[model samples]
Target: MLYPPLHHWLLGAVGEGRLNWLMLLLAAPVQFGPGLRFYRTGWAALRHRSPDMNTLVMLGTSAAFAYSLAVTLAPQLFPAGSRHVYFEASAVVITLILLGKLFEAIAKGRSSEAMRTLLQLQPATARVQRGAQVQEVPVDAVRLGDLVLVRSGERLPVDGEVVEGRSYVDESMLSGESVPVLKESGANVTGGTVNGTGAFTFRATGVGADMALSRIIRMVEDAQSSRPPIQGLADRVVADFVPLVLAIALVTFLAWLLVGGEAALTNALIHAVAVLIIACPCAMGLATPVSIMVGSGRAAQMGVLFRSGAALEELGEAQVVALDKTGTVTQGQPEVTDVFVDRGWSVVDGEQHLLRLAAAAEASSEHPLARAIERAAAPSPITRQPPSRRSLATAFAPSWTATRLRSARRGSWRG
Candidate 1:
C-alpha cells in the first residue's frame, strides 16, 4: 500500500540517476494519489487565506515535482549543467510524514492500553441467584439488589455489599493498594476486585454504568479527550505559523533571484522550495502529541503509569509528589520490634494461630512495614487452609485495628 511500500521504494530510489523514469512513475502516483489529500487540504486553507503545515508540505512537494517534470520534458530550456531532477525529494517527504503519523498512532495506542487493562479487570460473567435458582449471566445483566456469588480468585463484576460469607478482596487495580481488603457481611465491596481464597455472596448495590469500574473508565476517557493547558499556546502558534512561513519563502525566492546573476531563476526557486520544505508544520504541529507520547513512554518505563495523555501533561506542572513514608524515601527495612496482644487473646494463649495468620496477611505487601511483619511470622512454621499468602496488612491498614493487625500478621492461620 501507500504506507509501507511507498517509504521503502522512495528511500532506496533516492539519488538513483539511471532510474529517473521509474522514479517519475512512482512520484506521479504519490503526488496524484495519496498526495492529493494534502493538496485538497492545502488548497482549502489557501482559499480561506489560512495556511497550515499541509500547505507548506503541499507547496514544497508541488514545486519539486513541477521543477523535476519540467526538467525531464524540456531539457533544451535548461543547460546540461542545470538538468537536475528531484523526484525523490517530493515523494520521500510525504512518505516520511506518513511514517511519522503511523508511529505516533502506534505509540498513542500503547499509551492508552492502561485503560484497556483496567476494563479487562471486570469479570465477563457472574453467578447470579434469583430465589432458589442460580444462573450464569453477563455482567451487564446483573441488576441492583441481585445476589451475585463471587468465587475464590474470581473478579467481582459489580459494586455491592456482602450479604453472606467472608473473603479478602484485592482492590489493587482500582486503588493501587498491594493488599487485599477483608470482606464480611454488611461490608461493601467494589467491582473489579479479585476475590481471595474464600468465596462470598453479595447483593449488588451498583450495576452497569453506575458501577465504580464503569465510572473509572468514563473518567479515563474524559481525561484522554481533554486538552492540556499548553494546547492553547500550540493552537495560537499554528494559527499564524503558516502565513509567516509563506512570507519567508517568498522573500527567500525574491532575494535569490534579485541578487544572483546568471542562474538566479533556478537558484531562487531552489531556495524557495527549500524554505517551504524546511518549514513543514510537522514539528510545530506535533508539539503536543509528541510531548504527551514521550512523557507516557518514559513514565511507563520507570514503573509509573498515567491515567491519560492529559494527565501526563498536567503532571509536568506538579511541584509536589505525595508518597508513602514506609517505602518511598527510605530503605523500607522495617522490623517487627514488639508484639502486643489483647488481654482476652493472652488469656487464650493464641500465639501459634497469631503467627500463622500474620504471615499470610503481610505477604502481598510491597511496603517495608508489611515486610517486617512477614519476616517475623515466617519463622512460625504453622500451616492452615487459606491455600496461599494474603495482603491483609496493606489491605486492612485502613480499617483493621492493631490487635486484628497482629492477629493476621503472625502466621499462616486459617479457620
Candidate 2:
C-alpha cells in the first residue's frame, strides 16, 4: 500500500535524477511543516524525561538532509563524483511520514464525535418556578435549590429531586435503558433526560460541571487525553535507532572509500542515505493513535463510552464486570400489585371502598403507580370532573377522602 512500499519508491526516485532539485526545494518546508511537529513533540517528550517516535524520525531525516546537502554542494569532497545525491529518498520519506500523520488526525477526529453527541444533549433553557410564577431562563443561570419546572416533552435541565409533581422520564440518554422511568417527589432525576406524560417541578441539586452528564463527558475527554503504555516502547526504539543508523551510514561510507575505491564509495553513500530514509519511524509513531481512535469509535457505537486510552486498554484485560442494580439488574418500574389497610384505617363499607379511594387519589397523576391503579379500577363506574381550583387541590391532598375525590375527578372512581 502507500505505507510498506514507500521506501522502495524513495530509493527509485533517488537512483533516477528526477527528484534532485525537487527534493532540495521541498525539503525545508516539508521538514518544518509536518516533520517539525514530530520534531517538537519528540523534544518535549525528551524534556519531560521521556523519549518518543518523533525523536527517531527527526534524527533520521535530519541526518539524511545533512548528508544529501554535503554530496549536493561538494561532490569532490568524497571522491571523484563518488558522493551521489539521494534527494528523492529524503523527500519521499518526509512526504510519506506526513501522510501517516494526517491519517492519524482524521481517525482521531472521527472518534471525537462521542463528545460532540454528549454536548448536544444539554438543554439551552429551563423553566424555573420562582414561587407561583414560572420563567424560562438560561440553563447556566440556574443554581442549586432552584425549583425547575419541566413540562411534557421538555428535557430535564439539571440533576435534582422531583419535588412538586410526578412524571415518567425518558432516561435513555443517561442510563442506556429503553423504557420511560416514572419519577415522583423524592425521586432523583438527571439533566438531559426527557420529561414524559406530565409537568413536574424539581429542586436543582446539581448544575454546571457537577451534573451527571457533564461528569460523563469530562471522563470521556480525560480518557482521550491519556496516553497508552505501548507508545512508550515505540518512542524508546525511535529515539535510539535514528542516531545509531546515521553513525552506521557514516562508517559504511568511510569503509567503502578506504577498501573498494571511488565507484564503491558512491554506491555506499547512496545506500547510507537510503538507510536513514527507509528507517524514518513514521509507522511506529502512527500505530498507537490510530488504534486508539478506531477502538474508541467502536466502543461508542456499542454504548460503552471509554474516557481514556488507558481505560480501554485496562478493559481488554478485565475479568469481571460490575453493573448498577437499579437500572441494570431490575426494571426501574413500580407496579401496584396489591393493597391492604389496618382495620382502623379501612373503609367501613369494605375492600371495594378502600380500593376506590386509593385508585382515585392517583388517577390524575402520571406516575407508574397511577397507571397501575387506573388499570386495576377499570371495571368500576367512573366520572371525569371538570378541572377547577378545588379539584386540583383535592387530587393532591393526603387524606383518604381527598384521594377518593381526585380519583373521581380523573374518572377512576367506582360507583
Best model number under lDDT:
1
The lDDT per prediction is 0.72, 0.70
- Model 1's lDDT to the true fold? 0.72
Error of 2 at 350 (Å): 30
Model 1: runs farther than 4 Å from truth? 1-19, 79-81, 220-235, 255-267, 282-294, 297-305, 314-320, 324-375, 378-415
List clashing residue pairs in candidate 2: 52-235, 223-307, 223-308, 360-407
Candidate 2 per-residue C-alpha lDDT over 1-415 given as tens digits, one digit per residue, 9 for 90 to 100: 2475774686686652445455677776776766678678767876775555666566667767877777666656666444555555555666766665666566556556877888778899998878788889999999999999888889888899988888889897877564588888999999989888887889999999999989988887776666777665665665676557768878877776677654775667666666666777766655666676677667767756765666777778889998754554444554556666545443354455555656666666666666667666667644433244464344334465666687899889632
Question: How close is every model to the real structure, measured as TM-score?
Answer: 0.69, 0.67
Residue-wise C-alpha lDDT for candidate 1, range 1-415, written one tens digit per residue: 2597875576576643445666798899988888888899888987888765667778878878888887777766755677777787888777766665565565556646766877888889999999999999999899889999988789898999999998777776666665567899999999998887788899999998898988887876666566566665654665587778778989999998899688888778767876876766555445556666677667655546566555676677899988753234433244667676544442244564565666655555444455567677776773434323244433333434654656678773432
Model 1 lowest lDDT segment of ten: 387-396
Model 1 TM-score, all chains together: 0.69
